[model samples]
Target: MINPLAQFALLLDADLMAAALQQHLPECQAGDWQVTGCEIQHPRYKTYRLAENRDRSFLSLVYHLRGRHPAETTAEQRILYARAYLGQRSQQAYTEAQANGETAIHLAELGMVGWRFPDDPAMPWLAELMDSRQIAELEQRPISTIEIVNYRPEIRCTARYRFAASETEPARVVYGKTYADERGRAVYTNLLTLQRQSVAAFVMPEALAYDAGHHTLWLEGLQGHMLTELDFTVGVAEKIPALAHALAAFHQVTPPPLLVITSQQQLKEWLKKADKLSHAYPTIQPALTGLFNELRQDCPEFEVLGLIHGDFHIDQLLVLADGRLALFDYDELAIGDPLQDLANFAADLYNYPYPVAVIDQLVQTLFTAYSAANHNQTDAQRFVWHLRGQLLTRAYRCFIQQKSAAPQRVADFIALALRPWPLAD
Candidate 1:
């Protein structure tokens, strides 16, 4: 029996297939050009390089033409048709992967299959098709191996493997890193580190790596305890106290050094430069600008500029076996008013489902711990103002984004920000 892939190659080459395609797609034709080999380059379309002799060559394909069908003579219809075809093919490939028991296969990698039969002289064609640098790298690293242990589409890229070594068994290692898309939208990675074999564990969930292309290796996974199964949820009454204690412990540690941010004029210039770095939302830009302005104004009055977790949401906090809450993901860590950190915690509280009494209790516990740690250097009232300003700014940004897809929860949060719950006097 012929290989299924080989059958696919023949189908790709047959006149019948071309004829059928021509009925709907007149541009596609089965010429005397011969197909040596075909390989999957991307998920959208199969690329075929044909040669009449050893020198003269041409490329052609029958791909999904997106947009509307051509009514008269326009490229728009063909483009639309191609896109639709690619979408259908991508879905089909995903369905097949699910049927085969594969977990979260990337649709973009498997869609629109392409491969030449072994009988055909396609190896040379394949060699010629690769980029010069890629070809050189492949030759230089002929013995290298790649092992993919686990992968979640747009979430995590976990792998374990070894580079070529002479005397030793390939060094076994595991890596886990978060992934991002073309738009720079980031995903969270749970990095659980074990300091000892004790029952207590400190799991740190952070943006492990900024580069989406690079992988994160965790050697501890092979030898240390796997605490991924640990349960975080306990009695709702204790969560606030637990979180407050954790935040206090984290804030108590002396940071490396106080980072001096410039005045509002300088900050505006900095923001202008930062705006060019990525495609920030238009609504978010103004709010971020306002946030920087407020911080500059408040910085002189507030002496302490310590290490603060910039985005301390519920997801960033990990509860250990010993009942200690550890903070992780310091990618956005910056030296700012400690109240900014408090604001982040407050923002998280707004998002998470917990009683108002619990929030009050948590705030009181946090203030007490912070005051004790700082030797009464910091005032709670000033921090509250900072928190309020940050909240107002964040609320405005979220509200703008919500305008397009306004959910009830988001609407409620906006309302809450506008008319805040009065703090206990």
Candidate 2:
């Protein structure tokens, strides 16, 4: 049976969208351009993008998020697009957007909604959060441009711009992570709280604020850049100590806000992922099964020593000013065998476009520095066990992503998984 939501999404068909453009925007009609993609999969509104045939330039169609009509919080089922908050939630913000035509167009009630591209047309409720004196200073140095770098209604909305920030007051990045329903706003709210509390030891983008009503999070943009993009041929090994030192410092915090995952259930969950991967990709079945069987025999019961970055890799580290390294994305931060992080970091070396031997040395250097900073000797046995687990888990994930697992790649993971323990001298 055809799903109702799927049917609704089809309403904004390419032909229909082309017709709408012809009627409303003569300059942007299908006569000169074509509908190349339709991204309005959301049930609340329809959206599409037009591509000019002459130049291949694309123009985005705006979708007004306003619900069918205003509803009391009692009728949560029908509440839409931050509409329920017209009076009770953010009255001042609604008034501002309605006056500015960014939103809240009252054509005798719920009529038309859409953000004009290259304009402040969405999430007018941001004004409510920015009414403070500190934010009022923005009048002097206002944002000159707004560019949507990424957009997915249910996931997040990201924009970068000429943030004319001054030495005194800096501009903050705006973010909003959405959910199936607005009631699930606690996810980002809790994350912002965690970000605010973890600033002492970790280098991360600071969380400025989270407005539950608007489902937005303001973050202080870091001055540094992502390490993944850095060409670190010479200084790559040198930064291991900084990375290890920063990670060790972050773990030292008393009662850090994250879950501990040293339990057997966690290991079982990993095994299941491996089992599923082997079943899904029959090509790696024999090698993956052999590796899992060995892991089942070698798996150990370990205790948590400190916090571990569940997804420790070059991609998660940001190289800051003065050669300092800061970690990004705390959603995976957890308390586990610290070696879980070490091994994950080691296993991820395969991802880099570098010589395997060079990164192997770098991983050794990283673990050595980690031990030195930690002031505690690592149990080589446990380290080896986690190393194999991470390598196999990562291999499974690659398969899940449909990355072509050449015989060499599968062999590499299996070889690492079946390699000699304690990483012999």
| TM-score of every prediction relative to native | 0.42, 0.61
| Tens-digit per-residue lDDT, 1-425, candidate 2 | 22222322223344554344334432233343322223332322211122222122111223332111122222211111222111122344456666765634221122223333222354444334334443335445655444444453334455443455778877644433322234324434444555656444557665555556656555555667677666656666767787887777766655455677864655687677666655445677787777777767766755766766677788777777866676655546666777787788888886677886777777778778888887857566676777788887766655433234433565577677776643534
- In model 2, the Cα lDDT at residue 143 comes to 57
Model 2 residue 16 distance off true place after TM-score fit, in angstroms? 25
lDDT, candidate 1, 195-310, per-residue tens: 22222223443332333333232332232322222322334335555455555555655554434432243335434432421122343444445544554554444255565666
Model 2 poorest ten-residue lDDT run: 76-85
lDDT (CA) per prediction: 0.39, 0.54
Candidate 2: where are CA atoms >4 Å away?
A: 1-141, 145-153, 157-162, 165-200, 404-411, 421-425
Q: Highest lDDT, which number?
A: 2
C-alpha lDDT (0 to 100) for residue 370 of candidate 2: 80
How does candidate 2 fare on TM-score? 0.61
Deviating ranges (above 4 Å) for candidate 1: 1-175, 178-239, 257-300, 354-361, 372-377, 393-411, 418-425
